[model samples]
Target: MRAFICAAAFILLAVPAWCGNIRLENKKVRFIFESRHGGLVSMEDLGQRRTISSAGGAPVWEITIGGRKVTGNAFSSFTHRQTAPGRLVMTWKGWPEAKNKDITVTVTVRLREQEALSDWHLAVEGTNGDQVPGIVFPQIGGLQHTTGTNLAVPNWMGELLANPGEQLKKPGAKFEWFYPGHLSMQLVALYDQRGGLYAAADDTAAYRKNLGVQLGADKKLVYYMVNYPDQTPGRQGYSMPYNAVVGAFTGDWISAAELYRQWGEKQSWCRQSRLHGNKVAGWLKSTALWVWNRGTSAEVLEPATDLQQRLGLPVNVLWHWWHGCSYDDGFPEYVPPREGREPFMAAVKKAQAQGVRSLVYMNQIQWGNSTASWKTQHAERYSVKNADGQPASHVYNIFTGKALTNMCIVTDFWKNTYAGLSDTVLNTYGVDGVYMDQTCLTRMCYDPSHGHPLGGGNYWVPNSGRLSDQIRARVRNGKEITLSGEGVGEAWMPYVDAFLALQVSRERYAGVHGWQAIPFFQVVYHPYALAYGNYSSLLTPPYDALWPAEHRPANMLQPLDTAFNRQFLLEQARSFAWGMQPMIANYKPLLATERKEEIDYLLQLARVRNNSLKYLLYGTYRRAPRMAVPEERFPMSRLSIYAGQKDKVTAFEQTYPTIYHSAWSAADGTLGIALASVQQRPYAVDMQLKAADYGLGNSGKIYLVHAAGRRELGSYAGGTVKVRFELAPREVCLVEVTPE
Candidate 1:
């Protein structure tokens, strides 16, 4: 055994004292470890004058062994060394009071040669697979938040805490979400006006783990991604298959996102993805608007058809509640439409014949608690259960609050049944597509009988993916059809044709400050899959109000004013600028008689998208050009339309950039910078674009393209071009650049 650099610094030694803090450095960052307990002592960016890490008071790593939990500080023995330049090796052993002397953990940190970051890895020795739950590595403490500092997390539509330190101190802030599920991406970063410290699990395989962004003592942030070992019995010692990245960057989340994009684009999920292969259905690729409606032919079919003609754009009707059974209380029984089989089917056909893609809504996970099939068909055998043996259940019915059990997709019986249901919707119902709700949701099932791991493994990702494949090959029968889910989960990007980013509405958790919803999802996956929709206001028929008070349009539509209308336009503009196909939810005939200004703007946006399809629809998302514009905040409220519940909701001010701008690049070296006005009056914008930054040469032709027409803005002869323009009231336009 190698002796410590100093005796007392490491252990009692049973001898004279001699020890010192072990320092390891690379060109990008330097790390110091306290030999006494191997805690992270300090970390400093080579370019900055301050330390980004806190004092050496936190454990270097943590793990669960034989159902017993321990940390690096729990070990009585430790050793460390710089095995090579820009690399350090630390080992911890002699834990559990000699009960598991065979257990040992090794921590390795390396400064990447070409990247300004440190690569981390961990290997555990001597443990049966099931005996070890997971390992938490490279834990960083003392991330104190400051002024203008923000924390970026991959949650719904990508969340940004404008003031993270203050926000985390607020009530009801989530500490962590599992990767590729509750957490959309596998990374977290704390950044500000100065620089950022970024951490991510750079595994293309996308191991299941908790990307812990928890609150530490003294109002600090602790970031550690928990990596699970395969739980199969008798498996060998676990070594991290992918490197954990911790690095320093010079900008905001977008800069770190670029670094992640480098690794994300190469995964099988991205490489073989339909978007990357350009295999997205032509109908979806050309689609610019979605009209989400519920109910029979009168409420849905008529309005959906009219909107297509009115907007003069392809429209999709995502129809919900066409079946005879109660919306949330019926499972595996969708035939005999609400109005009748013939009328509903005919409406679907007529809408399709008129070019309105009809997508029926189905919740794949929920099985009504009182459904007959649950007992007669022995559906309990195919449902998910917790470790305590309770079924996973939810109550979404607004009036009744009835519960539904979640079905396990990994089970063979459920998979066959689900696909068979989809087949009926496609063939018998005659819909063009199926919007599979909850497909992107993750569940931790402990039912070993389902032929998958009990919990905390990669079972959910591939099972959900393979089921989509089976539905296409079996249910869809190789036809080009859209399969969509609720939110964007990175693992599902390659499997489904589209994902609905309803979070764009920013109405869910209103009243919460420091919350900013950005299009970080579209930035990463717009090209990989079509993302659209939000729980914006509905346009239900006045006849909807004629229904029972509890089951009426009044339940969905909120008391409105000009401010809310302005907010709606801003949201739709955001969806468009962020590269998402715009969605109008719950459209009813009553809408035709109201909101004329909003309707006109919607039509104009459709035209703009159609004209710039090469860039806005299918191009790559580059960094959005910054606009030092005035901010606008409109009073807003949430509606429980999607959740099928009617109750008091979050109310707050929705903020917007009065003049919005976004940058995109087409495959042919054309850069499209979109600009829109959220105000009722014209807004002027004068900005500069660096040609070479977007891969454009010094000289290029510039044009201003709008839904109505286009006009050349003359040619630029330098690397930077300054363009000045004023957008009309509620205008949506694109500034295009092409090589001369």
Candidate 2:
């Protein structure tokens, strides 16, 4: 399709407006636009000669080298605000009438300080101060197509078509929400005509650059808690048992304390969920444990065996439907066979005994099923209507003798159904949480035949070939309610504590590099981190499954148990722990036993560090990056205590050969260094103190370095200490030597 061009690149409201409608204040500019014609529209930073874009603005804006001069209208002023240092103009442009005649449009942009934190608010009012709704500002040269009615662009065209909604699976599709900044940080929501919502950007590539500043990519913590709807809807004050609860992800964050406060609120619903809130109260500490299951089937019973056999620990189990079932089954209505439930419950009992909680899956909305037939009898309306004004059909339900339609979330009937079902599941069946699925698909429905419940039209709905306002509205409202695939944009942060899953690319550094750029951009919004792997992680195309010994027809990397996969498994475990992001293993049903073991290890690790694993996993810690202490204040050789003057070190353990970079402070600190061993073979390490490493920066003092038993070796360091065995392969010896 040809690009859609707006008659006016930027048009302002002819009425009175304030701060140019920039929500955060002067630090950032807000572009609230509706695209009728789509093409690139550039916002040039005159001083830096830099630019940002919207729509099809990439040709002229995204490229840093030689590019074509953006054709079409010259930029015009919509509104202007005069600030102390400079004048902010809410600007736009219109197609040139004749070769060089100056275009009449000029935007009046205003900048103001954000009332709250680091954010700056910007607003672009019309020359006459009139407000414009649905204004979208693509960075310089972004593609602009004839504006569709939907608010969000379809997933990026890496592989998917421009209109992914029309396709069942958006292949090679990357969905980025409204990011109108140098550092694309905030994720925008797309509200659909069907009265549903979706957070478009939740992955690494999309989140790093928000509102501009380029932060170095480093994995940060992402903690998420799942809060179910009050089975009674508007009513408050009912409680559910802990066992009836559902799924959640675990991780660390830069601002964990504040996030924990927000988590407390989302979980407020759990109070009415019939849970003894006290059980999870200690969740704040590192010792709190939780479980995430790859598939929800009869085999879930194994969770009990694993939980009891191991630590006999308290855990929470998030049971999900098998892959084919997650999409094809009729959501909550598509119950597994009765035979499956018994074993599922038996596993739940096992988890409960081990202090584990189990949460079941609930559909976000019914898709594929015909609304007429299913709605007529399903009693509980849980399906959404499609663009054709009919409920979509199911590929699986038809094959399984359970053809069903999708449900509509906007309808009172559907809302009531959720309350009834949730209440019954929690109270009657003794469940804890409801793991709602597919929240990422919320968008607008343009079927005029049905009454529109979410008044403002769906922003996710498409118009001609572009996004529409109806879809945008649906995205916004959905933010007001639930969290799903939508990433942590500044706008939707409050509603989402974490993401359901994190999908990433295969290349490690590229993936991690993209993630590191988040902090310098936006901090208010955060989402749990997740990445892709053919193994446990969810794969779009079926991946090579790890077969059990009996199932391995041909030799691959088949492990006797899952022990062979330890390297990658441990790395992943450590990554989640270090970056402060939670790990969700989306493995298939056939490999539940192995996946469960890894899950057990992760939960145990999380429990040890007061729920803070970034230090153990990533090792590149910030908050208090460096420290210095006086030698006199140092503790004994076997001591584990704070070394710095601030006493910031909560706990420590003496180990070996750990690489301490120049980042450590040694001014007046301890006179000794700690090392497990220095020999290639089994041998004790002893040395005299030397100040050479610290140079003149350290006070001239010497001390003796003692040695302990040798340990095993690993690939990274290439040597080991003398020891019969090293339970934690990652743990090394502490080399302690003082000044000479």
Candidate 3:
């Protein structure tokens, strides 16, 4: 028995233990950012004296930053939580071990106030321990493939990380602006497989050789090398050629709270806050609703007139569509007007009179096929060749042996095309703005036939100065143009005012399992299959027309159905739009008719959003009224959205009762409690409102109230209201019981 006990004791002692240790000094404070004059921002109060220490065990850490601490703990990686006013605390636990020691770990916090965009860096020395040195890179991943694969790989081979071997080294790293509010940061720490006294020697020179930084179209921010200990300048890693596949830029210790805050502040319009709208971004102050149509002369004219009649002056709407083969269309061969441009120019005149912004679309590159005489003449000058040395087919000039098209935007042929097109639109049409579509296809051509004498392929390929020069010319032509396209990744951030990102796959959903891994900085609109029943197709022409002309007969009267939880769907869309960044409506098959139910629902939601648009435009947003996910232990039962008080909101249930809950006010009027029903069915909620709720009543308008789609409610003063809803599988109902 004694021998057995001794053996058990030995076994227990030999088992591995995994944990982390963290220490915070008294002088430490949370980092904060604020805006300065001239549309510029700065990071300040970071240099406050602070001490950080850590012990390594597992390779992951739980760090939290907040204005104050709370008794009920929420584990959010390593972020600071705001518990009270003016107090900030950052906490971290469970970090990986560093090199050479039984316990590898060290933590250092830098407090610096910098005016430049990329001004922060951190470095760790070779310490005795088993901790893995890690670095946090900034910037939403680089431009993604339109194929819906979001891997941050570039089009060119040498544009990004060239040698993985040198990535894990002790070479010094630098940070810079890849796009506005997006950063490019790099760090190096040795990875240890075993505990030791001195970490293995790292070839710092090799690591430095691989360093590279990419700026946006415009150099909006200056690059800065942060001064820190244990960092030396040496070329250790290889400088990749352009268009290389760099890994995705995942947020490390830094939380995106500041990004959210800035977005909120920029959303203000008409002196009201509109951040609560379902959709918003870095550009638009709040969500607004109006009809949209393609750029056909008849359609643009009719819709512009109709919208102006209903929505008042300054229509603030869009006239979208390109008359010729669109950017998405298979061909991009530039064709001059079949007629003398009389009809198209007349359409532009009518649209401008009605106060509409007309956006034209066209393929940035030429299709190999020559549909027009001009295109046939310039075939050799424009189209990329296929692997067989033939001109590429379909919409692409397959210069890379791949099916994708490469635009010779810089070639003399392209310059002529653009100049002619600009002249037609600007001088003759008097259009407000130009929408250059699908410039996103700018990439390297791999085919030897289309290769530049200097070896240019995609935008990522190491090239002669030709491609860059062409880009400068297109925008420099003295006409105001709004550049847009799908998957306009970080690589193109600086050039475009709004980013039309394509959230194509299931993996791209903001609610997906690990959605946090991807970031959308500018305004981005996710495209959904309208006919798939997930979203309302009200904005598009009736779905019956969606099928190919030969596929089926049209079904025009689908009797606008509000019963499909249309209200909640709009809310979800609005939320997502604003949540990601600046963006525009991406409804395809641009519809002709106005689905009034959908329009009213969006407009009401917009009314609420408009109130706080200013604050939301420039403010950071937290995923609030917390969304419940499968991985979570507790599914959300109830939700209450608050701006300031409880009085303002339109509450509703759009789905199964199991998915939503009702709310009740507490006795002291200080709290609102939301409860979810256990069963999936219709239910009623009783709410207590404060005049300040949702910034309503403050706006002095009778706020719109809705639940599901059958009913509407309004409130003049703070009071208790009973709300009922018909729940759907997954839906959200916004309430505006207050004024605004």
Question: Each candidate's lDDT (Cα)?
Answer: 0.75, 0.28, 0.29
* Residue 572, candidate 2: alpha-carbon lDDT: 41
Q: What TM-score, computed on C-alpha atoms, does each candidate reach?
A: 0.93, 0.46, 0.44
Clashes of 1: 3
Which structure among the candidates has the greatest TM-score?
Answer: 1
**Model 1 alpha-carbon drift over 4 Å, by segment:** 1-18, 66-68, 128-131, 170-174, 230-237, 475-478, 508-511, 538-559, 642-645, 649-651
lDDT order of candidates, top first = 1, 3, 2
Q: Which digits, one per residue and each the tens of the lDDT, describe model 1 over residues 436-545? A: 88888778777777888766667777888877877787644556788888788778878888888876676643544666787766676666767888666533122222
User: What lDDT tens digits, residue by residue, belong to model 3 across residues 313-334?
Assistant: 3333344444443223334432
lDDT of 2 by residue, 187-211 (tens): 2221222211111222221111221
Mark the regions of model 3 whose C-alpha exceeds 4 Å error after superposition.
Answer: 1-291, 316-322, 325-340, 366-370, 373-375, 384-404, 410-412, 447-481, 491-493, 501-519, 522-536, 539-553, 556-568, 575-595, 616-618, 622-740
